[model samples]
Target: MSGGLVALLDDIATLAKVTASSIDDVAANAVKASSKAVGVVIDDTAVTPQYVSGLSPSRELPIIGKIARGSLINKLFIILPIALLLTWLAPHFLPFLLVVGGAYLCFEGGEKVLEKLGWLPGHHEDHEEAGATSAEELEKSIVSSATRTDLILSAEIMLVSMAGLSNEHGVMRVAVLIGVAFFMTFFVYGLVALLVKADDVGLRLARGALEPEDNRPGPVDNIGRTIVRVMPHVFSVIGVVGTVAMLWVGGHLVIANLAEVGVPVFHHVLEAAEHAVSGAGGFVTWLVETLLSGVFGVILGAVIAWLVVGASALVRRVRARA
Candidate 1:
């Protein structure tokens, strides 16, 4: 009996060690994968706020919450299993899917640019249009739009995570993919919630400072007001940054994908430029490559958008006559 008990104890200790190692592996891989997807994450953060832009203060948080929930569902319930299957069954298909995702990012970025430049109609005019709607309707609209956007961003994130995983057992792959899905959904939506509520927080602080008890104008009030005043500009900056991020990330993905598929011209050009600059010109080289990539992405995006838009219009005309 004593000998048997000793053997069991030793077995339990070995199992514990195995479990601990598995946990560590999952964490390390999740972190690495999340970092690889940072560009897409930045664009996700930048793009999300626009969905809540026209919403009233009271509806903002709730709408963000709804979208966050949807994003969670998307990652865990939808994207994870699909990602694992693709990784296991059809790894070669990933680059093609990523290229499709890149095209989508380009299309979205190009559309935003066209809207800002007054070339696209239906630019969101919040005060006039959204003001007429009920708060509940507005919230639903915002949440739906946000969730749709999240689906695409979530797809990109999943693909990045899938690419980062080692060719391990199916169970290990599933564990890492699910772990990353949860981490990214929480990270992205939590940040979005904070950003959406920042203006309200500023307003509350301003009101508190302006209370009659304080009497004289205080620095707090001034700062609060300043935040309120600058919030729109902040959102504008985020919009521009998001568009630029989309283009940059999309272009980078395309370049990387092309290199993966055996075309190395762009990669070689970038490397030669980096070498020519040597130590002193590193930053300049990076900037030039990034700018060129962005320009290429934008041109490709615009052409695609034009084709899509024109095709849709023709279809609509045919339908109308029919």
Candidate 2:
């Protein structure tokens, strides 16, 4: 009886070790996969803040919260399952889907450029100027728009993550995907919440720091005043950065995808640029690649914008007659 009990105990210890090893593998895989999606993660962060801009001080945090919630749902409930199915059943379709996503990024980046150049018009600036809108109405519009945008970005992120992972068992794939989804939503939206509340935080600090004399400034008040002064510049910088990111990332995606499908032109051009710099070529190489990518992104974006606008007008005309 004692001999039998010893053998059973030894078996249980081996099982425990196996389980621990499996958990470690899952964690390592999750991290690896998540890192691949970093570009889309950056894009997500860049794009989200714009949705909350131009809202009143009190509505800012609440609007961010709503969008954050929607983003979470998009990743977990919607994107994760679809990603798993795509990976499992239609792995071959992944690259094509990524190209479609790349085209979308290019189109969006192009539209922004046109709007900036006064060739196209978007309602975003006008909406910001139309003040005193009800919080509920604003919240609904912002959340809906944010969620729709999130879906595309989330799809890109998921595809990147999927491409990074090994063709593992179904269980492991699902686990890694779920892990990536949760991590991205938490990281992106947490930063957004902080960004949207920054001005309000500054205001509160300024108001609380009452001067001992009516004419004197308190430390908190001074700090708040500084923040208020800087807020406009900060937001302007964010907007500029977001637009640049869209162009760079979208261009990079298209170039990379083209290279993946055996297009040698972009790769060879980048290689030539790298070689031209000789010993200190790394910086030059990076600059060349970025500039080329931005150019491609802008061109692609413009073509897409033209098509979409023409299509929309045609549709409207057809509907009016019908």
Candidate 3:
């Protein structure tokens, strides 16, 4: 009886050790997977703040919170199930879906470029144009647009994460994917929340400095004013970076998917460029590839934009005639 009890205790210890190892493995894999999607995550973070632009300072965090919740829902409920289904039933379709999403990113990024160049109509609908009769309506519109955009970005992040964990098993894979999703949403939105409120924080500090010891501007007051002044430029830089990232990632997707589908010429060209630039430096090779990808993305995006715009015009004409 004593020996049997000792054996049972040993077995329990063994099981506990195995469980602990499994949890550690899951965490390591999730971090690895999440790192693979860093570029998309950066794009997600940069793009989100634009949605809250021109909104009341008080509403910024709330709007960000709502979008983060929607992003969570998109990853866990919509993207996860669809990704698993496709992985199981029609794995080939995953690349196609990725390409489609890439094209969308390209279209959006390219349209912004054209708008800046005065070649395309502006897409941004500011608060006045919204004709929002109530705060709720305006918030709803902003949240809806943000959520829609978040869905695509979140899908890309999840798909990228899954691709890295292709070798992982059933329950482990799901757990890691969920971990990545939650971690990314929280990180991105949390950073965005801080960014959007930075100006407000600065303003408060500036006021506080003035309220205290001396009514005259001090070093602290100067620092606070500097922050408030710097935020707009910071946001503009973020916007530009986000647009460029979208273009690069979109084009990289196209090139990669094309290679997977057996057209390898572009990949070969990039490889050759890497080889040629090896004598120079790794950074040069990366820069060459990135520039090439951005160019491809811009061209693809322009073509798609033309088709979509033409189609819309045709539909408008048809409705007018009817």
Each candidate structure's count of clashing pairs = 0, 0, 0
lDDT of each: 0.78, 0.76, 0.85
Candidate 3 achieves a global lDDT of 0.85
TM-score of each: 0.83, 0.80, 0.88
Residue pairs in clash, model 1: none
lDDT by residue (tens digit), candidate 2, 1-322? 9999999999999999998898888778888887766656766776787777676777777777777788778878888888777866987666666667777777877897898899987845233324427767657777787888888888877777777775676888888778777777888889877766777888888888887678577888899888878977876776666667667766776677677777758767766766776466668777877787788888988999999999999999999999
* Deviating ranges (above 4 Å) for candidate 1: 1-18, 54-56, 125-138, 166-169, 211-214, 262-265, 278-288
lDDT of 3 at 251: 84
lDDT of 3 by residue, 133-179 (tens): 78898888888888998898898888878877868868999999999
Scored against the true structure, residue 42 in model 3 reaches a CA lDDT of: 75
Best by lDDT: 3
Q: What is candidate 2's CA lDDT for residue 187?
A: 81
Q: How does model 1 score by TM-score?
A: 0.83
lDDT of 1 by residue, 130-188 (tens): 54377666666666767877888898888866766746567777788788888898898
Against the true structure, candidate 2 has what lDDT?
A: 0.76
After superposition, candidate 2 runs with Cα above 4 Å error: 1-32, 35-39, 53-59, 125-141, 166-170, 262-264, 275-283, 320-322
